[model samples]
Target: MHIQIQPIDYSIILIYVAFVIGIGFALKRYIKTSADFFLSGRSIPAWVAGLAFLSANLGALELVGMAASGAKYGLATCHFYWVGAIPAMVFLAVFMMPFYYGSKARSVPEYLKMRFDERTRCLNSISFAVMTVFASGISMNALAKLLHQLLGWNYDLSLWICSGVVLIYVLKGGLTSAIYTEVLQFFMIVLGFAPVVWLGLKDMGGWVTLKEVLRNVAQDPAKVGLAHDTALASNAMTSAWQPIFSGSSANLMGVDWFAIIFGLGFVLSFGYWCTNFLVIQRAMSAKDMGAARRTPLIAAVPKMLFPILVILPGMIAIGLSYIGKDNYRLPPVAISESAYPAAVETFQKFAAGRMNATATTAALQTIIKPKLSEAKIAALLAADSQQKLDSSAIRNGLQDAVADNDYDGVILSLVKKYCPSGLLGLALTALLASFMSGMAGNVTAFNTVWTYDLYQAYLAKNKNDAHYMWMGRVVTVVGILLSIACAYVASNYSNAMDIVQLVFGFVNAPLFATFLLGMFWARTTSHGAFFGLLGGTLSSALFHGLTLPAGSTAGIKGGWLATLTVFPSEMAQNFWLAACSFSACLTLTLTITLLTKRDKSDNELTGLVYSLTPKVKEHDLHWLARPAVLGTLLLLACLILNIIFW
Candidate 1:
């Protein structure tokens, strides 16, 4: 499908980019030291930090990829927010924040070093830096793909434009610039997509109409050419909780509630929200400990509402397609040579019968003219007799032709179809903003890890603050360059979320166990923490490898060793893999700590470990203003949402 890009759209995008760059340059003078460059001088307010914390994770993947999943899996995708995100955000705010903020750790890895040892910190720092670069590339790649598909923009040009913009601003203002731009992007994204969802619902005749259409389509597999049975498809599309406990093969998400709760909710969620410095750095930049603690909690409010802006577009697109209002449809063409002969014969027979029986042949001719002509039908039949078609190939081609799975394009397609030119510019700009926010977040995190955790701490420990600050700027440029390379590599992957989850499984999944033990269990010796982390990471890789399908290169393909066993779905396999890895890490860490020498004194562990840390004295703050109160409210809200949606 060709999309016409209006001049207004280009102008709006250009203005947005310029404004963002201006913010970066405006904040340049603030980077007087490495801490200022990396941590925003720890002067950010709770609200600003909160939004940035949310925006950091709201990259191209969240917008495009989640929309794609919404179309594919229906309401079940809400698990990413309700179960996988909210609880973890609350945990980070209420439980983990004290240590993260009180310990004066510059990065998550730095925390590891203080809690565990230098080796563990090095392991985390290297892995996190690599992950951030790769993640930034993925966001960049997704943005380029969206622009190319939606606006007919050149892919390479899009990449260059976005990368250059992100690089300029992030280099100038560092984390402060990134956070300020993120806050701006957060507003732009909401303003941009809120109308899209409103307009979509309006076009689709509102919520009831959409659900009705989806239900009708789900009940008839032939309508959407779905492979699943009627009941499965209908329930999968309409209800969030009804099919969650069923076999993975029965639901579109390919996972049961057990996996959702344990794999995603417990392990992956905690690991990411708690330990991933890419996002935690935003909270760490807050003006005070209370602000830092409230950052994720503040962010969680909007985070919970994102599915409406991001996921609903895909759901609306799917609904429109079912109701025959969407432009996306299977082409009016046949795949099989043998089927073509029969089709032509049937048309010919119908034409001949109508001609003989009808008083006016003109009427019959008019009825069939747009679809097929007698001459064309005869030609098709003649060609069919002359050529042979492979039945299997024809079947596969037909399946591919009919499956409406370019879900990632759903939102872009909707914007072109429904949004007017001026509004289209705003929506497109919002998309660009989201991609920039995601990339900038990762790039900023990368620079900090590279400069402080890796370079300064290990390679140039004796360097002055001024030299390190300059190196921070230099490393920011290097980070963006590496991210651009990774973006090219990311284009090869089919699913942005899947590849990201795989990376989390590799790094975050195992690392969370170490953090969990070290923070809560005083017996967790540095040797034990280090070895357990190593063991956990290895076990994650081993489980992942063991589950690879016969020909797949990434993710758990299926069953153990791709043959000895089989899983219900790739998602289910991944969750189980994470659960196993977490258990292994916890077990190994405990066992190792029992055998190894412990830390010399509780004094050394003060403010870092739970048992040794002093309890924070209560402040004369309002009840509602407390982190614990806010966290409870957020958790309750999440639970209520789940129950309502369930």
Candidate 2:
């Protein structure tokens, strides 16, 4: 929908921007060395580092992509938080943080280098550098798309503005700036997005009534003109755990308990949380090993409740349509070829400017509106169930339902609908803050990996601190430029989370297996780690190439090699492919390590290997303050939440 921003909104956004830039200037004087620029000189306290750790992950993907997934997958989206993130964060804090912090490795790749071989390090560094840029680009794409969808801003213009702000702050204060700004973004995101959720739920009566509406919308998503998750139900979309056990055919997500537990819960979650440098960098910048270990654990608390902020809005947005509030249907999408030909014709007509925007949207929605008739929707709205919103007024803001539905815009659309002028600016700033946080986090990560892992390791040696610091700042600019290029590539996908999972599948899935072997199994040779990573990544591609999601074409979405099997959904395919990658990597690494001789002695492994590393003495801390105790409590809380939501 077209949104009209008032002067108050613009002023709020400007003030927020000024504040972040000022933070960079405030911290600039402290950036004295490459360590300061890249790793915050290891001085940030536990709380700041912990919030930054979570906020960095709560970027564009967390806001836009999670909301999109919520609309498409329903309560199953909570899996990303409760199942996927919490377990991994707990594991990272209790098990992995010691190696990352105690070893004093500059980055995740550097950790790999110390643990394995230069070949392994080189492969990881390059792949990681590329992955960071891609992630940053995805963040950029979400920001640009949001502005375009809501405010009619030019995509390129919004992208550069977001990148430029991120670049300025990061270039000036380095990782410290990014981390501190992320802390600020964390607050802004919560304060800003709170209104939309509160107002949306208030307008819909309460959670109880909203559930009634969600049950209706979930059973027939296309009844509200939704493009994704076209075949889900109340059981699959409304419950957190039921659909998982319902079997693939019974659930729209098309995955069983095994896929959810193994693929997502174990491999994908650990790979991203334990190993990905983007979030790990925040912990690595912590002032001490204690703070570093607590980083992810601290991040997990708010993360447990984030579904209310991010996911509920998407459900509410579609629910509004079902309850006849403002005629708030999801926008139509560019039809997949497997769908109706008439919808494609309508979309093309709108694309080619052969029809008026309003008329084209209505016609397109009608074609794709499914068999759920208008009478059923009218009767349901008039039925006077528990849904107690003002049902008399149904404004057809069909202008928003154009030929394309950027599901990433779900949260933004809600802000446009429910937020007042002052709150609108705040909400928009929150979106902007999240975008910058994601971009800056990845850019900072990219610079560190490039400067230390690749440039210093291979291209140059023994560089002075001044030279390395300069390179770090220079690489930040290069990363921004590369990220802009990658943003265009990201714009091709509808679901931001889908593309993110796909990237993680290729990069982190196999890398996790390699890291697992190297850290615990000291017998793992460099040759084994290197080839295992390569083979794992290649295996992920092969599995993806051989399998095609149902109702999907064979290309970038997979099955380019040949469609040997068809998955019920792209997400399910991602899960299985990641499982394949992890299994292949672990097997290959073990087999190769058996034949290869270890070049480094057990004594050399020291802090780098878990078996060799000394157990951390926690006698100094209070019982509640200990990382293990806190992490156990956190997991218990998470388990309670899962059961409550189930």
Candidate 3:
């Protein structure tokens, strides 16, 4: 498992780190006030902000988790982008950006305060600030773990190195430095992964050969670790739409089309892209409203093609495993005398868990015969037939092996195996770029919310601009330190994506409901907004708690008050969780708005709510320059992709 790091690779990484720091120091002169520090003086261009917008989101979770999901679920994993992301990006550009950009609100929570009340803003600010810090930490932890696993670096050293680089750049130039570096990181990632997909496709004999090999692997029950059945596995791995509507247990994703459409496509997608300040801050920093409106749309072009870089690596890994690639194939070993009983017990437990004991026994024989003595295997099978062992204890032991789902490590494996020393360094640096971009984005967002929303608004009202600017710098340092602590905490969790989605279910899912009501429905009272937000958050917590027993092993354990239900899979549960929370927030907000008084007048609500806002005249602009036109084009592209993949 040890990988030799070449001098060239280390040098490339060092150069990347220095270049990032240089950018930070280069932009330090621009920060004369808190606004300049946090919002880049609201003067970034559409193209720059657009790439940063996408890069801010192209973190360890998107890179590692999406690839892992691709290996596990096949082409269906593209749903994370095609279905769950693009439409939302377009929606934010067309409908939400007008309020987000034109209102001149300092942050997303600040907008909530202007539209709703201080309580609602506070709720959002505190939750968002906390989540960003933790998310930054998660990115740090994932980077450290990857470096340790791939390059033989110490975990703490890796954590310090990565976090330090992010802190220097973000602390020096603040958002401007972060955004510019993010642009650089975006290119780095593209250069790094592009060759990986090319090499992989070349090795696998192109797309057609790869798909045929995958289908052949699917038909073999002995290769069931990659997929279940011939028809289901082949279609799930090759086609997106074919298996989406199948029963829960039929498809690899374990959710039907209903959940994918309403839950993921509509609810969770809009919630994150529209309401999450981590990304919205990027667009808000644009030089003008038109630039802001175009940021997400501009980002969408690369986003549509990202699956080839990220998800395809996993698909390639799975394909490589079938072709006996040294890194992808399982290693050979003979069972030790002491380990024989334990291994046999593991196979027996797997057998007993299934209803068809005869078929299970046959499968177990095929898997274990090479590693175990016939007598030992026979003894275990006889013991299982007689019901003479505790299936739970045996199952627990087997779970230990299953828990090491190193699907996330497939990309790292590809890098070490296929990349030469110089290229290896570049590839590794791309990973470092993704981690730093994720961390910097979160830290920048956290500092702004803490400074403008909480400190300036509540803790120290009427503070001088210089004082707040100083506080912003100080918070930047504090935020990175706190994120390091959170990174350590995150190390205890299993998969990066699962924990992130859990946080989204609790926070983003319901918050979007409040934003949806506030932006469109002027009748939404402050009380309705506040309580509905509270209600949505609680419902998310309740739904998550009820499904804890059925949730991913990666989730936080033992805090659930009760397990009232089970789910087909964690992803399906998460989608439903958002759907339920969104419905709860929408229902509560509407009902409470009807019962409460309208606190803000139409004049006060001008430019904030849709009905109260004046119509924007766009006839003067060229068709391509119009946000509506750009948004429509993006939506059409997404539809075509879905149809082709379908």
Candidate 4:
């Protein structure tokens, strides 16, 4: 794993780092006051906001985790970006942004406060803030682990490098530096992954060879096509292949088209686009409401295309395994059991011939080391069969010889192998940029919640700009340390994304359900929000506790329910995890809303039904129709690509 120090890689990474630092420093002048620092004085442009949005979403864990999943499953995993995320995003732009901007809230919880009551705002803000810390820590720990593994650096050192660098500029200039740096990071991520994809495809002997190889390896022709049975089956349980699907059992019925359309697909999308502080911060920084909405809409096109940027590389990695590419595939599953048969044969052959016994045993051990456990073999023999068996019995009896493997590592190894020097540098920089962008967003959101919800609302009722700004910096420092501690804890967890999102689901799922009800259901009370949040979270956690212990497997309880089952699969966990959360939240919200004392405010009642209002002056608002048409066409384009490439 020792890399030959390439001066070109060093230079490219150095230049990228310098560029980011330059942007951070350059943006410092905009921070004249606390509002300017935290919100960029509401003056950012659409394009900057757009790029920053993409960068904030992309991260090193995204690169590694996605590529790893692609390598493990196939093109099916790309659904998270393409089918799951994009349509939802477009929905966000067309329908949700207007409500958020038009409302003129500083944070999402602020919206809750305005929409519901102080208690709901405080509850959601604290939950979301804690969630951000947990999520950000996982991302940080993952990136740190990857860097540590890739560059032979210590994990703590890697974590410090990532957390410290982002914290410095963020604490210095807040959202202004975050936005500017993210634009550069977006380009870096694109530059880094794009060429590697090209090279992987080239190495696989082009698309035709890739097709041939896939046909050979998969033993199925339909796997390469959209709606292919094998692909669908592999991705069946989790809409990891498409956001519109899920599975359920007797204990839980899985997400249907409705759940996806309304819950994650619709609710999560609108929630993220309009309310997620990190995303809305960019919009909030915009000089006007039009730009706030337009920035996300502009960003939507690339958000749709991100599968091309991120997922395709992993798909290309899968394609690489065909056409005689050894770099991608690790040894097959059955190899662990079968390996000793071949090894023992070789050993017997050598012993009969001329190799020394000790030498032969050493060689046999080397060959069999990864496949057979000696204890398992001994136990198999010790079980006393009908007739006593000898060494030959042990060798021939071996049944399982699976090569234990790690696909995430495989993609990185491929990157190091085939990605040329300058491109390698670009890839590393892009990954770091993504990492920084994601971390910065998480940290920014954490500070936003802490400052707005706790500091201003509770701690200091009459603070001036200077006092609040100082508190912002102080809170940022404290938040960074807490995140670092979370990262340390996360170092021991497998699949950082899964763990982070699971924790998020357990907490945020209820919140998402409650918020949806609060905004749309006027009867939803503060009592409903509170109890709904608690009930939804507790129920999901209970289900998770029941099903998660057994290792993930296939063809069992399929999908995310499978994950929450004793048998886990990637989709299984996500599906049921979401199910538990959403159901608990919704059921509780409704039940409590019906029973609780309802608020009588006219504004509150009217707001719930606002979108249903007909445009009284349709002719006067005709200008809005053009963007709607354009946005539809854009959405259609993305759909066509999904049909073609999916």
Name the top lDDT candidate.
2
For residues 241-303, what per-residue lDDT tens digits would candidate 1 score against the true structure?
Answer: 777876676677678788899999999888889999989999999999989998999999999
Residue 163 Cα positional deviation in candidate 2, in Å, after optimal superposition: 1.5
Residue 521 local lDDT, model 2: 81
- What C-alpha lDDT does candidate 1 achieve relative to the native structure? 0.79
Query: Alpha-carbon error at 564 in model 3, in Å?
Result: 5.0
Q: Which 10-residue span in candidate 3 carries the lowest summed lDDT?
A: 395-404
What digit string (tens of lDDT, one per residue) describes model 4 on residues 1-646?
4445489988987787777777777777777887877778888887888788777777666767777665544554555655456665565555555555556677788777877778878877887888888778877887776676667668888788778788888877788898888887887788777777778777777766664554443444132221122322333322242423333221111234444445555545544554567776776677765666667667777777666566555556555544335644432223343566677576446544555445554565676654443444444434323345455554544432223344555446667767767777777777788888898888887887788787899878787888888888898888888989988887665555455666566776556677567656666788888788888878877666656523444332223344434532334455555666777788988998899888746565443324432322325345743446556777788678667654
How close is every model to the real structure, measured as TM-score?
0.87, 0.89, 0.87, 0.79
The numbered model that scores best in TM-score is: 2
Score residue 266 of candidate 3 by CA lDDT: 93
Every model's Cα RMSD, please? 7.7, 6.4, 6.9, 8.1
lDDT head-to-head 2 vs 4, winner: 2
* Cα shift from native, residue 625, model 2 (Å): 1.2
Better of 2 and 3 by lDDT: 2
TM-score (C-alpha, index-matched) for candidate 3:
0.87
**lDDT by candidate, in order shown:** 0.79, 0.82, 0.81, 0.64
* Model 1, runs deviating above 4 Å: 225-233, 326-404, 492-504, 548-562
Task: Point out where model 2 deviates above 4 Å.
Answer: 226-233, 334-405, 489-504
